[model samples]
Target: MARKTIITCAVTGNLTTRDQHPGLPATPEEIAQACLDAADAGAAIAHIHVRDPETAKPSMDIGLYERVVELIREKNTDLILNLTTGPGGRFVPSDEDPAVAGPGTTIMPPEKRVEHVARIRPEICTLDFNTMNSGAQVVINTPRNVKIMAEIIRDNGVKPELELFDTGDIVMANDFLAAGHVEGPAMCSLVTGVKYGLPCTPDAMAMASRMLLAGTEWTGFGIGRFAFPMLVQSWLLGGHVRIGMEDTVYLGKGQLTAGNGELTARAREFIERLGGEIATTGEARQMLGLAQ
Candidate 1:
């Protein structure tokens, strides 16, 4: 039997804007419908990041999360929900006073970062372990902050999807596991193609995968143009896969996807053409040890 692969669709990430893809789901209703449509298109899990309805900017608002979760559960209870805790980590230093935070700085207390996860209680929530330079700003996920967020997510009975951007992040994850901050053999994702982090290359991914703890349930993905290629690379490396507008707006060369569903369908086609089978929601739940 072909191994079953779990496809996670990340709809409307924090940075992906309407300018990049006009069809990006911004409102709660649109985000919920995007997840439902992706689930129908062969994605067993939806990696989510809510945005403000008016500004379309990423938000840590609990009400927005509640509405999105409520909407998704109303239609499809089987699809796994993986919310993100990555929005409140960027730090842009002021030009006049480098010691002070700039206009783009969004660093907040770790507890506040996972507040939505604790309340909404999704099946999974991403715990980013990278603290690297991102564009003009830096994303700061200190070990201390990561531990605090991990404790909160664990207490909520939500699995932390470890987001590893480099080898050092993987090392941090292993330490977190050993220290009991996160559960053993946790679910993780390798984020490549980001500048100053992991590069989108076969050898780079292979080396990172080798550094993970044994039996870790990991999915490797890339950003922008590297998305589809890394999806295949991830499967070839014996890991699961992820795709959606959050990862890329284009389905093919210069061809923008209609929505999350189209990106998911293309990912499913790639997996099937590689002679792998996409897991159903139930099977994905069982594989991840999530309650059925």
Candidate 2:
């Protein structure tokens, strides 16, 4: 039998991608619909992030998350929900008073950050493993903050999908594992193509994959133009893959994607062509060790 590859669709990220690509899902209704489409297209898990309905910017509102989750569950009760706890961590310091937050900053306490996950109780919630300079903005998720967020998710019975942008992040993740903050067989999302993190190279990805502890469940995501290529790379390496408008807006170069479903379909096709089997939702649930 061929290896089973799991496809995870990132419905909408907290980035300002809507302006860059109008196809990006903005409203809760649109996000839920996109997730449904992706699930129908063969995505076992849907990674979600809500945006401000009016401004189309990242939002930390629990109501938005509630609506998104309810809509997906109403449509497909078995769709795995992987809600994001990564927003509300951007920090752009003020010029005049460095300690004060600047215009782009939306920094909040760790408790406030995971408040939505605690309320919605998604099957899995992302726990960012490192803080790095993402372009001009600083993404801050301090060690203290990580511990607090991990404890909250662990206590709530929510699996933490550790987001590692670099090798050091994986080291930090191992720390959490050692402390028992996260369950055994740690789950990591190897984030590539971000500024100041690991470059979107096959060698880089392979190196990061090697860093993951044995028996750890992991997935790889490639941002922007590298998304599809990385999808193939990850699957070939016996790891899972993640794709969607959150990571890449184009189905092909210069061709805007219709939605997450298009990306999901292409990924499923690629996996099949590569002689890999696509895992169904039930199989993926068992693979990830998630609650039914």
Residue pairs with backbone atoms closer than 3 Å in model 2 (clashes)? none
Candidate 2 stretches with Cα past 4 Å from truth are none
Every candidate's lDDT: 0.94, 0.89
Residue range 45-125, candidate 2, lDDT tens digits? 999999888878888889999999998888899988899989878999889997889999888899999999888899989
Clashing pairs in 1: none
Best by lDDT: 1
Instruction: For each candidate, give its TM-score against the true structure.
Output: 0.99, 0.97
Model 2's alpha-carbon lDDT is 0.89
> Please, what are the lDDT tens digits per residue for candidate 1 over residues 150-183?
9999999999999999999999999999999999
Error of 2 at 112 (Å): 0.7
Worst lDDT run of 10 residues, candidate 2, spans 14-23
Alpha-carbon error at 173 in model 1, in Å?
0.3
